[model samples]
Target chain A: MHTVTVQVVRPIGDDIQKKAAERSAVLLLGCPQVPVQTSIALYLLSMLRKKGIKGIIAGNPAARRLVEVSDPDHHYVGEVIDIDRCVADLAEKKRDFSLCFAFIHNDAGVSYAATIGSLSGGSLVALIYGEHPEDVAETLTVPCEKIVVKATHNPMPLKNKIDEVLPWVVSNL
Target chain B: MGCLESLKYEILLKNASSKESGDFIRNHYDEVHEVEAGYKILDKHLIGIPPIAVGVEGDYVIFPYTKPCYGTFLVRVAVPEEVERLRKRSK
Candidate 1:
């Protein structure tokens, strides 16, 4: 696993409360069918934490475990949630997230990201990877931020993209 | 929960003939009715993800699941024990 640390920079004075209130994000993971999914998820979460954003990972049971097993020290992955329950919570308006970072590989993954973006009324960023990414991006009609990284077992490609886009992700959110 | 304790809940079997049971699952959980043949592409990819529920039939169980990325896939569960194990581990 790649070791990346986040430096939490808190704004001083009256802006502190507003920044604190805004320091929340959802780290959404697609099905952990591939090994890289887990790695990419952790990397994104770590970067988000560095930005002073609290992140909770939501995925299928297997996907959640991927993150857990990948991080024995419990440093990057702070919280893991069942995908269905998380969607239900979003649907019911129980948790209004500020942003959703969804790791997608296929069409279904695209749908999940769009749905979360729609439901939470937050910024939806589609971190699309895997085969035929262009086709997958074409299929996506829902308005969202799309970051494309082509890979299967390696997380480096996506990590580089995240480094470049993290600022944009935070600024747009 | 152990298998026996888990068995207390409903298991949607692979060859379950009861329309009522199918209807029950549909009504209760997030369901995607009739996944068209064209959409089987989505189903093919879903095999990699974890299922939401296990449907136990006479000798086997099928996975009854819905994902935000795709529709419902009531596919045969190849490894029920693994699914059960993962469920327990998650708990």
Candidate 2:
């Protein structure tokens, strides 16, 4: 049974988590639709589902990215260290053919997330960008071999933009 | 040539690669309203010297490269002839 983990690099906020889950779930459906070894796990620092997750690391950059898009709940899931532990936590929750993705748009601290994903043994990378990001897919190859670089060159706000495009992206993914 | 060789050659290669990358983002910032963009190209070739590397030979153009894959250079994607036919149809 082939198992995969989808890790989207973003701040752990209610909106981002929800969007990430939907995006991950959408991509999950594309995985041969096989029941065997099929599981979906999310690597996020959300307060709502904190107890449900294991292998929680402190100071992990992915957590920082999640922090940037924090919601009004004042319940930010901050500080995760020991990257190896985070990977393990994610691995434990892994299911077969899991599709991890991120919703990073207009993020100033995007480079760090890219770096973490590269070093974290990620198989696939879904780069979310607005303007052309100067070959981000190539930059992220050090940690990941196969990459699915998704760029949104549309000038609409991401929330509205996702509505128009997520359906297509989800279907193809 | 001998003196040049003996001297420490720390030439500041004028960070063209990153400059080009920044320019791409700035110019198309509004048009591509997302935070970033992706470039998909095929057949990018490169050759480098032992110590300090240079020259990124890609499918279309060759330019100086400082960093390995992240270096900023023009990414030329060759358009298939069928697409060109479609463009001519509009004219």
| Interface RMSD (Å), every candidate | 10.8, 14.9
DockQ for the candidates, in order = 0.09, 0.03
Q: How far off is residue A100 in model 1, in Å? A: 0.5
Residues A1-173, model 1: lDDT tens digits: 99999998765764865775577788888767756788878888888888778889888877887789889898988878887667667766778678888787764575566556656778888888886677767756667888887778887888888899889878775
Q: Which pairs of residues collide in model 1?
A: A108-B69, B12-B55, B13-B55, B13-B56
Supply fnat for every model shown. Answer: 0.13, 0.00
Candidate 1 lDDT by residue in tens digits, B24-69: 4456544223321111121221221222233334333444344544
Model 2 chain A, poorest ten-residue lDDT window? A28-37
**Deviation of model 2 at A30, angstroms:** 25
Model 2 per-residue lDDT at A16: 53
lDDT by residue (tens digit), candidate 2, A61-120: 434334334433534333333332332344344322223333222222133233234323
Candidate 1, superposed: residue stretches over 4 Å from native: A1-18, B1-65, B68-71, B74-91
Q: In model 1, how large is the Cα lDDT of residue B82?
A: 43
Give TM-scores for every candidate, taking all chains together and pairing residue i with residue i: 0.63, 0.26
